[model samples]
Target: MFKKIAVPVLLAVSGVAAAAEGTTTTGVDLTPLTNSIDFSTVLVAIMAVAASLVTLYAGVAGVRWVLRTVKSA
Candidate 1:
């Protein structure tokens, strides 16, 4: 069923791509722009992940401590 629609679309796209002019990449330099970009979001995400792990560890420890105390009593 999908082949009926996909074949013609694929052939059309290929034909257009084949007929495209000046599809060459020459002298493209984005070094200066990329170098100045701040990557603080990735650091913040890592800190958030650390916070979640700490919270999970604390919850598990508290539950285990309460269970131990109850069992001892």
Candidate 2:
């Protein structure tokens, strides 16, 4: 009973508080590091390579299992 009422009230209060705060910004400059490249693209490429390697390993293991089963039979 208390939970349902309290949740809505709390949400309403927080919404009002956030609206009051608005979009305030502090003036901090990052112009010095503009020349240094963003590593986001490189990070994504590395993740792709890792995923491909894992898939290849799984595929090779499956092939080896099939071959061993055939030989035993």
Candidate 3:
């Protein structure tokens, strides 16, 4: 009984190990995929400009608010 159960388990484990080792080599080139229109730089520049505008607007609004408050006082 032990021999029967152990033999099938060992065979299943060996089959799984062999299947894991059988890797197919890919022949596809990925240079074109990597070189195609990188947008990270443009995205970063746009994000920087947007952030600067938001900061400038915030500064201007803060100054205006302070001026109005001082004037009211």
Each model's TM-score, in the order given? 0.52, 0.51, 0.52
lDDT of 1 at 12: 97
**lDDT by residue for model 1 (1-73), tens:** 8999999999999988887764666777899999998889989999999999999999999999999999999
Residue pairs of candidate 2 with colliding backbone atoms: none
- Clashes per candidate (backbone, < 3 Å): 0, 0, 0
TM-score of 2: 0.51
Candidate order by decreasing TM-score: 1, 3, 2
Tens digits of per-residue lDDT, candidate 2, 1-73, equal: 9999999999999999999798668766777787587899999999999999999999999999999999999
Top-scoring candidate (lDDT):
3
User: In candidate 1, which residue pairs get closer than 3 Å at backbone N, Cα or C atoms, i.e. clash?
Assistant: none
lDDT of each: 0.93, 0.93, 0.95
Error of 3 at 17 (Å): 66
What value of lDDT does candidate 1 attain over all alpha carbons? 0.93
